[model samples]
Target: MGERLFLGVDGGQSHTEAVVADERGRIRGRGRGGPANHAEQPGGRERLARAVGESVGAALREAGLATEVSEVEFDAAHCAMTGGADFKEEVIRSIVRARRLSIGHDAPAALAGATGGEPGIVVIAGTGSVAYGENGLDRSAQAGGWGYLLGDEGSGYWIAMEGLRCALRAVDGVGDSTELGTRALRHFDLKDFRELARAVYAGRIDRDRLATFAIEVERAAREGDASARRIIAEAAMWLCRLVIAVAKRLSVESVKVAAVGGAFRSLSLREEFAQRVAQHLPLARVIAPRFDPAVGALLLAYGAAGVDLTEEILSNLEKESGR
Candidate 1:
């Protein structure tokens, strides 16, 4: 008989990633595809299917397991996505065949990856932001992740929007002068704030596109722009609040906390966030994630199949994946 195979997928707002692993917890292959969120929108189900199929198919091919068949069977498959999993089971089943399947929110997968399914918190700040944690008591809690229109405080979108607001205020001579104005104008290739305002109002730029401006904001902060620094500081505070809220709910005195996502790529922002978290939760330790969310999903897949995740397996995974 062929060797048993397992699959793990992280379907996020920015993109979808899949990993194929063997029974011994060694990563065989990995693949990436387009975003796989909003499964309830028009054409959403098709998009999700395509994203999953594209990523998983590539992984299977890389693993030397792809055949002429459209559907690949797996011993177990676990998918963790940005939105809740309630609406995606049927769509996923149509794309892949698995003996054991588990689908749920992306937070748990992220947490599991960050903490190795131990007890801790993971703060994910991408286009949006959220903090999720477990306390080893079969209890878990989450904070933030309200999306752009609602909260998403300390997220890339929030930081970019705050930078733009500061630029507008500065241009109008109502706020502190900073380099954000020139940076913003140049980043968007706009002649002036008038053009910027019109483009945004006309829906020419979506949240994801706008959220990328946080990079410019981060650069400005690094260059010592006071307004930019303040924005980042505020963002750090907001993110810290998320950690504190989860910690309080979990009622843990000490826990391992890892910050994940693109926004945390900024060293300045990461330092600020670490400082803030330390200030509030002195007992909580901020550490690097042992693996990314995709690997986290893979860990969950192992759990779903009743596989024992021993030290040898984890060491093999870390050695193979370079996590």
Candidate 2:
């Protein structure tokens, strides 16, 4: 007889977020926790479980619903994770109970959030990069998202790795000499290339840690470093290719494209991406996201539970969540 409660979660390489909402589509609470990317890695399942428990538990408490994540029962729930859903579903089921559940990769959730479930494409550049689009006809397509080893061309990790490579090349006196070398040494708190190499080879600098340097690269570009500017331009070009590929595959003359994630935090990058999309696809428009991926998962939860969300309800969600 209590009010119907819904749940949404966005699990990414950098962090995990949980949102609690009421039947009227107003955000009740929000919570955050550490990363939950690869469930097949060592202790991945346990890490995923703990992340879910922590984020959900915090959200439930904030909503004044339950003290523990296990104590709360949801009418419906949706989870969108960086890694695929197959392995995560089992781990999630062991932690929380929901009458209806939907689980998938983060791309669709991001698209839903970007366009509010309408037909559109979303280009996400976080620790990794991917582009996904829907045609509103149950047809969808994706580009990139190959991860760090093979792809992730426009991602934060990629940008940072490129910066490091440029710096190393400068050290060898074979590449463009720029501020990246001095900046990287200061950023990593190392005295020289030998120390930097030692930290990297010893696994002291992991993928996420390296990705944090992308922001510094952006700083270098803003400060008028030619090599850094080229890196940014190239990253923008690669990301635009993703958008164009999705648009062509969907065969849509016009579509809204939204950029999401940490890499877009740089105004320079966002402007570059928007400009590239405009040049390549004149009909395509780059728009700001109406909601973050977590709320997009909540929207999917509402759909799965047969809840018809009105504009008023969505407005409440937007206003209350401050999105």
Candidate 3:
């Protein structure tokens, strides 16, 4: 037998990421691809299969290994993909059946990455938003993730929607004026409110694209747009609420909150969210994730292989991730 290796995947609505690691939890390779939301995409099953195969193949190639390597040489493979769909499970089962791989959900992979395989809360705020945390014995709970329509508050979609609403209100003189109105108009290439309204009502502004407008809101806020700032502040508050809710559910006095996604990357937004969370959960510690979700996936792979991850293993993985 050569040596056993493990694989971890973070399959999300926006993108799919994979990582390969050795028994010691040291990342050896990685790969990434586009969205894998099986519930929404056409031919979602095929897309998921291709994404999983391509990502895993890339990692294996990077590690100078073959898919058909000796079974005794590989420890295990696991994946965490988004969309709790029956089709997703079917797709995962197909992949595992074909390659003898193991798989899981994207949330647990993110949790593993955030807490160094320990128990902690993870807030994901990309195209959508969700908060997850684990207790002893691997018991876990999740909040939010109601999607963009019913919930997904504090998400990129929510922020963009609020920004558009602010713009529309300003146009109607129902809200304070903001540069966001003009900026958003330009972003969508609309000359006026009438056209913007038509586009929104027609479902022309998809969540992925609307999320791009969030940057405009951020810019306007920086430029002293009162409405933009208010919207951002409100979004931060919603995110903080989720953290508090998760902490209370777990009954942790000082929960570690790891913020992930493009939205939380903004220092201003992170600071605002941290402040709000601290106000409610006084002992909560809101911090940036030490490693990316893909690295977390790698940790998950190692765990599935029955490897106990120590601080040294995590440190090595962090160093490899350039953290």
Best by lDDT: 2
- CA deviation > 4 Å runs, candidate 3: 67-74, 96-101, 197-204
Tens-place lDDT digits, model 3, residues 1-323: 56667777788877788777776666778777667775546787788887776777677777767653232234666677765776666776555432335566677778778878778889888888888888755468888888888888878878888999888888889988777888988998988888877887788876688888888887888788898888889888888788777778888867788888878765667888888888888877776687778788777667666678888888878877677
Identify the runs in model 1 with alpha carbons over 4 angstroms from their true place: 67-71
Best by TM-score: 2
Model 2 poorest 10 in a row by lDDT? 81-90
| RMSD (Å) of each candidate, 1 decimal | 1.4, 0.9, 2.6
Model 1 lDDT per residue over 61-155, tens place: 88778842155678999999997646699988888789998898899999988877788999999999999999988899999999888999999
Instruction: Flag the better candidate by lDDT, 1 or 2.
Output: 2
Clashing pairs in 1: none
List the candidates ranked by TM-score, beginning with the highest: 2, 1, 3
Question: Which 10 consecutive positions of candidate 1 have the poorest summed lDDT?
Answer: 64-73
The digit string of per-residue lDDT tens for model 2 on 6-25 reads 99999999899999999998
Pitting candidate 1 against candidate 3, the one with the higher lDDT is 1
- How many Å off is the CA of 151 in candidate 2? 0.1
